[model samples]
Target: MAMAAARVVVEAEHLLPPGGLAPDAVQTPGPFVDRIVGLGPLGEEYAVVRR
Candidate 1:
């Protein structure tokens, strides 16, 4: 997350959402996919139903 934020700050002076990064800035993908996989079926099965 800090990498994402640094990418934004390098390009813009003001506060920006994590999505505001340039394509090149996001060189490596975040741990999002790995985390989702770790969460497994129970995670997906209940994520929406409970939320």
Candidate 2:
């Protein structure tokens, strides 16, 4: 790990609609994540990413 307090930014195609992400669908676990954001080029969603 680079740093314990390190945070990462993630850009995704779409935000979690309403149902949320399924356990199997999620690539990373929630504890490792810091936060989530919504990014827009044409009104898209953004999220926090970590390793």
Candidate 3:
């Protein structure tokens, strides 16, 4: 199980952008607070929240 999980993570990482997901200067919409926008390697969008 651990190996499988690690493999999945590695595959996912490969799908990420060259430098990995980069935090955008824009903020997420809606009532959520402290969330930032991110872009992936394939131009995929992500809403990331930092603790």
Per-model root-mean-square deviation over C-alphas: 12.8, 7.8, 14.7
lDDT of 3 by residue, 1-51 (tens): 433342221222234443455557223322333332443454324435322
TM-score of every candidate relative to the true structure:
0.22, 0.46, 0.16
Please list the C-alpha lDDT of all candidates, in the order they appear.
0.43, 0.60, 0.34
Give the best candidate by TM-score: 2
Task: Kindly report which residue stretches of model 1 are placed more than 4 angstroms away from their true locations once superposed.
Answer: 1-16, 31-51
lDDT of 2 by residue, 8-49 (tens): 554566788745878888775666667667655652233343
TM-score-sorted candidate list, best first: 2, 1, 3
Better of 1 and 2 by TM-score: 2
Which window of ten consecutive residues has the lowest lDDT sum in model 2?
42-51
TM-score of 1: 0.22
